[model samples]
Target: MTSFALHLLRHGAPVLPGRLMGHTDGEPTAEGIAACAAQAADLGAAHLVSSDLLRARAAAEAIGTPILDPRWRELDFGAWDGLAPDRVDPDALAGFWADPDANPPPGGERWSELVARVSAALGALAPAPTLAVTHGGAIRAALHLLCGFEQHQLWALDLPYGVLVSLRVWPGARPTAQIMGLYP
Candidate 1:
């Protein structure tokens, strides 16, 4: 079966560090751009893609000219976008976390929705080595979809800013992934 290598690089730290930044555009700090660029330098993927969001785009652009795709954007936090965790309604936040599918943030995209969108985007790409600069949420969704990981298990990934996870995707009746490396 034909396969593709995907280097999923999480965007660098945003100007606002400790907020629910989903769908909220934030600029990458200079240091953040430098870190992500350095991490991306040796990846050597033939193609580069990025979320249309500012932070991810900045990092992606630093490494190479990237095809900006909205489908690669972070999970939409809706009313909670850009708000600090402590500021959101506790019960609502907990409920959303407990069952992301059953309870999306008030107007936010559901977990399943995010997974589907990202899957569709990935599936549409040509099978080849590619780098996608994206958000942590999008990366988590890709991991969940390709690795059969239970949603809650994803939280333990602990992927920080500028991390790169290399994956091989076997496209078929069910697309699958094998982790190649996790680069710091």
Candidate 2:
């Protein structure tokens, strides 16, 4: 099977950090954008894509002209979109952490829904050296689809701002990938 390289880079810190930033459309700090650009500088990506949201788009623009795609956006948090986790009901928060599909944030999407959208995005990629500037949740959703990780394992990824993970993708009707490297 022919394989191509795929890089998934998490967007940098948003101006409004430490909140449920999912689908919030906040901008990244200058330093945050710089950090992301510096990390991707040597990646030699032939194609670049980003979430249309400002936080990820800013970092993608710092690197190169990117194809802005809303499919790469973060999981929609809905009622909890911009609130601190503590502000949400503790039980509800715990339930979401434990089983996102079973207990998504009110008015938001299920984990399976995120996986489906991300799978579509992954399937649409052209076989090339590609980089996608996206959010932690989007990256995690991709991991779940590509790596077959359980929800419990996905939470442990610890993908911080500006982190990038490389994968070797054998794309086809059933695309699969081996995680090549993870750069913090």
Candidate 3:
């Protein structure tokens, strides 16, 4: 069986946190940019992929490799996009977390939908060592696929800015992950 290695990276520090970032474009902080460069230096990927978001794209570019921009973005928080975590309704947040797979954000995409899109994108990528720069939600989704984690558990995973998580993928099986945190 032919195996491929995939490096998943979370984009560096973002500007806003209130609303759902989903497809909203945001740039990385100066420190975040440095972190991205450092992570790229650490991974040294041959092929790079990233979310179209400016933050993610910048990170991909810093890697100094060919990058593919994919449309599989983070879950749309809809009307909840820009609200702070504390400002959001506790019961609603709990409900969303309780059944993430089935529940869609007030105007956002469902967890299952995001998973499917990411899975398809992963399938379309060339089978080789590659780096994917994306958002925390995206990384969490990929982790769900790679680790068979429950939706609630997705938040449990620690994915810091510009971190590189290595995974080996095979046909019809869960990916094997080697998580490595890098310096900014």
Task: Tell me, by TM-score, which candidate is best.
Answer: 2
Q: Write the per-residue lDDT of candidate 2 for residues 136-163, one digit (tens) a residue.
A: 9999988888878887899998999989
- Candidate 1 lDDT at 136 equals 91
**Candidate 3 TM-score, C-alpha based:** 0.86
Clashing pairs in 1: none
Candidate 2: stretches off by over 4 Å? none
**Of the pair 1 and 2, which is ahead by TM-score?**
2
lDDT of 3: 0.72
Q: Rate the local accuracy (lDDT) of all candidates.
A: 0.91, 0.91, 0.72
Residue 58 alpha-carbon offset, candidate 2, angstroms: 0.5
**Candidate 1 residue-wise lDDT at 139:** 94
Q: How are the candidates ranked when ordered by TM-score, highest leading?
A: 2, 1, 3
Off by over 4 Å in 1: none
Error of 3 at 40 (Å): 1.7
Model 2 TM-score on a 0 to 1 scale? 0.98
RMSD of 1: 1.0
Lowest lDDT 10-mer window, candidate 3? Answer: 175-184
